[model samples]
Target: MKVIIIEDERPAYEKLVHFLKRYSDQTEVIGAAQSVQEAVDVLQQKGQQADLLLMDIQLADGLSFAALDQVPLKKPVIFITAYNQYALEAFRANGIDYLLKPLTYDAFSSSIDKLKQLSGTFSDPLQSIQDIYKKLSKPQYKERFLVKIGDHIHSVPTEQIQLFFAEGRNTYLVNGAGRRMITDYKLETIEEMISPEQFFRVNRSYIMSLTGIKDVLVYSNSRLKINPSFDFKEEIIVSREKVAPFKEWFGGGI
Candidate 1:
């Protein structure tokens, strides 16, 4: 069967290509695409000659599923995604099978077999694609933030972080022991990595950890001021809309 592999990572694309060549005589990869744009172009150029798509959920530019909205493709897709088991129900519901990353040749073959068994084609795949997109768009509740420090990458345990603040264009992470370190992520990106039970983004510039909160002082007109034990020149203020949720989060309503 003619196949198109749509994966963003070069190493992963090469590995899958090598394995496809080695694993099965039933499948033949006709073309390899690195991004949604590339896949769309190849599809528009090749049309129905491309029989199947070995797809990845996340791409370097954006989610791979978003490609469907832009390009009209009817080819069956067997998804390859990093382990996000929360999305399996939607995958199953949508009549598509997914292979978790670090996939073995046997597992890959079995998934293909399963897809072939279930009519060998996906119908309304974009609906499931939309569901996956919706789930991924929201904050994925993760436990820790991966912080890259110089040459070493560290998982700064979420509980150990005191506060996150922005200066100019960079964001800094302050830990419980009064140590500050530079983080590569922007404020909004880091916000998704933190657990809402213990962290709150008070404004566009700051996301403070619960462990760092020393006191909350009521300010003018229902606005609240946060006093963190860490040294700071300006007081952290909570917007009026955030006060209720902030209180609920701080009060352990997680």
Candidate 2:
């Protein structure tokens, strides 16, 4: 089987090449590349003459999926990626064979066997990677919300948000900047989307931006009340269970 490898890291690339050499006498390395640009150039020159592609998900210029988008090649690709929970979902969703990084011989052989099994099967390659990118890049902070008004969409920056409050079954974005928006996401979902370093879930009903914090006051039963930049009808409170985590986040683990 003649194969082309598209990977950016030199050491990892060289190591995989060495491992493939030892894996089988039937497999021949026709060419190798260190970036999506170089890989595309190689594929353009070689065409269907290359039998398979050993690809990496992230490349120097952008995503390796960008290469597949531009190229018309139909070779089966056995992907390599460092294990990340989010990326793993994409790999599984697309019916692609992937080997997690620090590639071992057993894992490499299994992935290749899977690739060889599906060598001629047709598949859609671009959608899964694009989907994951879209999911991760949304909702910069719990404060900033994605607002859609008719055909227009805007990212309301977190600094302008006064507070997030859970009312009934809905979460509302109230802005000190003088606007209010209703979001169809749960408070927990927003917490996961926002950067942990900049935002904290102070209570079941609220997530506050560090920059918006005005002061912290001790309250009964080891609870703490927070006065945030944008005032609210109810005092913002943190539970005792969450206090240690909150301190560690702000104090750098002292």
Candidate 3:
């Protein structure tokens, strides 16, 4: 299928392409647009050529809905976004199925298969796309993880997790007991699995739980430091760029 992608993030765009290729050779990305304005331009010009559109909710200039507002799109759109409850709910009410970021093949394929299945009989498939996503919009954040421990497997609840950390390509889940266990998922992917209300990605290496934060201190360089319940044994510095948002999160979101 000839598709157009409207996304601002390069990594996310690449992931979508990667998963599409992994799913089938029949998929082709005809054009890519970074902002809502650019997406409108591309869609207006290449509107006839595209069979599908995979759109992102947040764009460089504004929301993807702005582009859709100006353009009358007949092609099937598979929405892409970082996990936002409100955004997902909006798509569930108005558009088609949306794929959460750090895109996986299973979700990608399922979205495609459903589109294919609904292609016939429904003269206006996009009209009913909201019903599909609305049905799927219930809170489905990860509750527990099944991990292999030598020859045995264990289920760890979200409540028991203190943080998820990555070191040299290895990801580990540190429990409330301060025990670190290897996990199959990367910190970036794990960030999407857990509720943002309970966990916050402090930096590239750490996704920490609110309850785990024991205290905060000003670091030598003026960056904030978090002392967690379980010993990380690593400096949990809140990066300079994230300080404002971190403060907001620490103080409870606005």
Indicate which candidate wins on lDDT: 3
Each candidate structure's TM-score, on Cα atoms with residue i matched to residue i, is 0.53, 0.48, 0.55
lDDT of 3 by residue, 53-88 (tens): 888888878888788778876566778777555444
What does candidate 1's lDDT look like per residue over 138-171, in tens digits? 6545566677778988888767889998989778
Sorted on TM-score, highest at the top, how do the candidates line up?
3, 1, 2
Worst 10 residues of 2 by lDDT: 86-95
Please give the lDDT score for candidate 3: 0.80
Give the distance in Å from residue 205's predicted Cα in candidate 3 to where it truly belongs.
22
Candidate 1 minimal-lDDT segment of 10 residues: 86-95
Q: lDDT of all the models against the reference? A: 0.75, 0.71, 0.80
Best by TM-score: 3
User: Total backbone clashes of model 2?
Assistant: 0
List runs of model 3 lying over 4 Å from the truth. Answer: 85-94, 120-136, 145-154, 157-254
| lDDT tens readout by residue for model 2, 117-190 | 65566454565455445544553344456877668777887667656668888787767753557776788887
The superposed Cα distance between candidate 3 and the true structure at residue 227, in angstroms, equals: 27
The order of the candidates by lDDT, greatest first, is 3, 1, 2
CA displacement after TM-score superposition, residue 89 of candidate 3 (Å): 7.9
